[model samples]
Target: MTSTPSLPDPAGAGQPIVLPANGTTVAAEDLQARFVHAADANADMTIDASQVENVGQAMLQLLVAARAHAQAEGLHFAINAPSEAFLARVAACRLGEPLGLEMEKEREQ
Candidate 1:
């Protein structure tokens, strides 16, 4: 199943921004738009990365930017239910710290 980004609403305030299984450049636009929508609404951003199997640099960069944007806006940004592949790709790119991925473990506790 292809993941689609969801806009935050009162009824879905904590809904996550779901990432497509193939996190390549093709999905970057949709991802960015999702981030923009969340930022525009001054909402906290949560990413659902469980579907991500193969993520490319473009998608990774967008994620980093999204985190920075959320931080600058004083909003929380987190990834939930990340898949092993997603974690490994972020680690392979040495972006675990930047993406606040290690914090996921902390949050689970």
Candidate 2:
């Protein structure tokens, strides 16, 4: 339903940050807000995309914005495994390059 879902504490660790449900335009703003909130709170943040059900440009934007926001906040940012179903779209979006290799490496861990 929403890309960002609802506000929750990243708290550095405890739960895998998830981008649940289908990503849509309406969810982008919330996603950005959550990312900023995360950056503000966590010294480092891990985004788990293993539960990402669907994705779109909005989703891409969310990740990109989150990366930038987290970086600006001086927080380490990483993404868990992204679903294979949307990997192609993620690549095509041309935002993956900016997402860094962290997601891949994290997936391996």
Candidate 3:
């Protein structure tokens, strides 16, 4: 049987959640859990996507939802140090605004 994707532990207050290099559908559940944990902490959360090499729509949706949840709960949510691949996929999927990611071209600068 294939092993489930492992997610990193939640960081402490004001820390960033470093996303897995492959942020695809395979890790959707894990990603969701992480986001929930961070959001429920009622503190600022920074999602680091510097290592994301592969991503899918599910992951994008989760990020969007997490961002909204954080907003509703009065928590700060931000995406930091996004990888080129990650930005490209966000742009391709038109999730930049929802995911709070800068456009690929803009982020490349």
Each candidate structure's count of clashing pairs: 0, 0, 0
Any idea what lDDT model 2 has?
A: 0.67
- Which tens-of-lDDT digit does each residue in 1-109 have in candidate 1? 9999954472146778888999989899867777777778888888899999999999999999989988888988898899988987887777887888884543333
Question: Residue-wise lDDT of candidate 3 within 1-109, one digit each (tens)?
Answer: 9999854445555568778888778788876777777765565778888999998878888888988988888877899988889988887777887877657564444
Candidate 1 segments exceeding 4 Å error: 1-13, 103-109
Task: Note the residue pairs that clash in candidate 3.
Answer: none
RMSD of each: 7.7, 7.7, 6.7
Candidate 3 deviation (Cα RMSD): 6.7
Stretches of candidate 2 exceeding 4 Å from the true structure: 1-8, 11-14, 102-109
Please provide, for model 2 over 23-83, each residue's C-alpha lDDT reduced to its tens digit, 9 standing for 90 to 100.
7777666666666676667646687777666776877777887778777777777777877
| lDDT (Cα atoms) of all candidates against the true structure | 0.82, 0.67, 0.78
lDDT minimum window of 10 residues, candidate 2: 100-109
TM-score of each: 0.80, 0.69, 0.78
lDDT leader: 1
lDDT at residue 87 of model 3 (Cα atoms): 86
